[model samples]
Target: MSVPAVETAPLLNTPLYDLHLRLGARMVPFAGYAMPVQYPAGLLKEHLHTRAAAGLFDVSHMGQVALRAADVTEAARALEALVPADILGLKPGRQRYGLLTDARGGILDDLMVANLGDRLVLVVNAANKAADLAHLRAGLPDSVAVEELPRALLALQGPGAEAALARLAPEVAAMRFMDARVFDILGAACLVTRSGYTGEDGFEISTPEDAAAPIAEALLADPAVLPIGLGARDSLRLEAGLCLHGSDIDTTTSPVEAGLGWAISPARRRGGARPGGFPGAERILAEMEAGPARRRVGLLPEGRVPVRAGAALFAEGGETAIGHVTSGGFGPSLGAPVAMGYLPAGLAASGTRVFAEVRGQRLAAAVAPLPFVPAGFKRG
Candidate 1:
């Protein structure tokens, strides 16, 4: 019997669609949106430019939500029930990484939670936005209001980000990593966060949809800034060793095993103020203390060939599979192929040798320290 073709929803366009075309970007469907995957400069050039200079990315497809309540603390506590984070302890004008966990302790999505004084704003992956909205509405009390923001988000990333941004809003020069502040850009209010997926010093700016194009144009006018697309964005994040929710992590992966235990706040851990309340707390806490059966680790392939996702990993010269590649690709920054995968804790140590099955060949790979490139965040 002929297999039936699966129907797909029509792709949506972000506010910068026209600008992307003007800049000769190759549009591709991602997360139900038509986003630019690369520009005329090609993926290699874009990736390197972002590392050496500022690269502006149109990330308007990301989900931005505002959680409001008469008392911000009340909303924080309400959100804390669904995530293993200490939202109550998150101070205003700051943002923290968080994971939405399932009842089984698997990750639902990874998000950035920022305290914007009057409310908590979350930036979640675009693919999970609908589910995240429904999740908040179902879990939060009536007192908490879950409102989606119609905003266009842009990321200006690289070692040169601050200088380029400071030209528009001079105050951004003083903002350190993870610091969130509100500023006006060319008469439009924009929420600026000193954070990004790339392990570089940068800012994610949330601006009104109507003003996005003008602000992007202003920044692009700077010689240091180039209009980057999703292709470079992915390779950049891969080099940084940051997990992509559906790939490096998923519904079956726990935060502890994903090398994200650091996202769990000390206040929410065992013996802390409020413990064992969040979803999957029992399994997650147990994994935190005893460690998981497998852990996420970085891998370096022996040759120039890439060991992509889904490649089964094996012990050196062994037949049985021990793990699988979660995410993998060439590292433009390192001039080599790099990958990340889950492996038994005993074999997860750096320098440990393993073999990845590719094209009927068993290629040797070595476990390496994460973040093929060093982080450039201005953490104080």
Candidate 2:
């Protein structure tokens, strides 16, 4: 999807705005920020480079919020009331994906919750940060304080991320997926997490805003690490079957319907030890057991035509619409067009044939497993 153009001026800029311009980046408005959509190498090259080596991405527009209380247990329990994850059981220095939901079991936003020893750090979506902060403050007790950190976030992703990052912070090489730690790189303190959105072996570094440029430049100095922009980032995550906040998921999609039920811990499920204390727990838990009417599924279009978002889906040989694509694009790694959208439960199985209406033509598509390109996460 192309980044939307801004009609008005005065959009927020990240600390790397100057550096982006210097690198010949194509700037565009996204989530109220003038972010780099692509560099001179373009999205295709950037995407391919990340898959083969590493790509350094400036993701400072994302929100970094910290929750603190007298103890970690107290803070985790308070946070559990708002999200469906089992925060209280989260181990120290570990992170987990979670969803902030509404009372009706719809997703408000998806976020990353990391147990930062004495406190919890939340990485929320840029577009929903204000609302997510407000929600966090309103849900937590007085003892649990929610504070947004004035920091810049960077992601070093793909297969070569480990080698590039280890050159600066050698200890980071020991950490597995979802592990987090504080490290000093070039005398600058940074909180590094072994996680990212691209379904690759990578790390996300959160540092003081003032150090953003220096850190980014240091990472890009490596031959294997090239600066990546938002265009490739969106395509990478899309090919990984990850949901975009406002597009693939929103206030109307439930975690179960989105095929993110694994994010809801077993301990928080019905009949578990700490069952159903979050918002929409009743409906969420009920759906967990009974199943949702429709579910998100991966679609592999038969031909080279790329199906885009909002394209209607239809049943075989029937004009009646079954669903619509939420995120669709060409998967450079898979060498084919890939998409994801909601489909009836009965027709969501892999190998189930369907059709997508693109430009008045019904193109044949097949229901396939998610992550059009296999994930390369370092689980151990």
Candidate 3:
């Protein structure tokens, strides 16, 4: 007997697309979805609003997957073996950021993992979702079940995020940073965690795909919450000293070189001890001890000129190219040109003077500590 041809389904839209259109959002294609790049209110206002008050962002494009195993301990072990983070030490209801690597130690993608009772949940970047799923499935045992959560994820972030979310989800008022819990908002159940990529005290709410419209409408009904776009999201994270997957760091960069060695635990670093599985162990462990030849650093431009990605950095003489900018832009919070790039280890000091070639002109720049704006996460 002949088998029937399977029909391919069209790309799914988030429940908020209609609302986005009604709000005059300039829709763009991103991660296989029609998303808003900016709205009628514009990007600058959105960026400033997010820093000063609350900005609601739809990050539902990110992949949400859960790993189910026999028990928590075994699940943690299996996961720890794959990533460098100390998952075994992760307390219940807490989350940690980690990277997945290939055998040669190249990054597959950076992700956030949460200990959700007996199962572990992961939120990975949208661009690398397919590759990440393939990587996970190949590495994990057959007994472990992987379930993808196709839902809308929203982030209400800024200094005033807690106050805004509390108006709708009162239980979030007492939630601690990195803690996850199930809460009801406007009569709809959702997974809310006091976490964000903007280095602020915020909440990431995962709601049913179908209920996204109602849930967003309920929260946005508040006067304080405004819709933000990707343009502002990049600037906000950059100002917060966060890394962008393909830009600031990529498959070519190791955690050590990316200045993320803190993600590795002591148990994983002990001499002669086998750290859990993933990829690039020998080189990664070695770089952890000896340090990387090039390190990611923060830069401040001297003049009114703003440096951009791929701009070449030079030593004091401005003749020899030493490094290049990965992510760069005018930081609205800093009110100046702030950027991040990889430079030779020797020149990666706080006070080291450097130069960047922008528009054929060499501009004086200095190495500055990351997080041009201080993080205001509500730790308690």
Please provide, for model 1 over 284-343, each residue's C-alpha lDDT reduced to its tens digit, 9 standing for 90 to 100.
999999999999999999999999999999998799999999999899998999999999
Task: For candidate 3, write residues 147-199 as lDDT tens digits.
Answer: 78777899899888898888887888888888988887877788888899887
**TM-score, ranked from best to worst:** 1, 2, 3
List residue ranges in candidate 2 displaced over 4 A: 1-9
List, residue by residue over 96-205, the lDDT tens digit for candidate 2: 99999999999999999999889999999999999999999888999999999999999999999999999998999899999989999878899999999888889999
Tell me how many clashing residue pairs each candidate has: 0, 0, 2
Residue 37 miss distance in model 2 (angstroms)? 0.7
The alpha-carbon deviation from the true structure for residue 87 of candidate 2, after best TM-score superposition, in angstroms, is 0.7
List clashing residue pairs in candidate 2: none
User: Looking at candidate 1, what is the lDDT of residue 246?
Assistant: 96
The lDDT, on a scale of 0 to 1, for candidate 1 is 0.95
Residue 97 of model 3 has an lDDT of 83
| Pairwise TM-score winner, candidates 1 and 2 | 1
lDDT of each: 0.95, 0.93, 0.85
TM-scores for all candidates: the values are: 0.98, 0.97, 0.94
* Top-TM-score structure, candidate number: 1
Residue 162's lDDT in candidate 3: 90
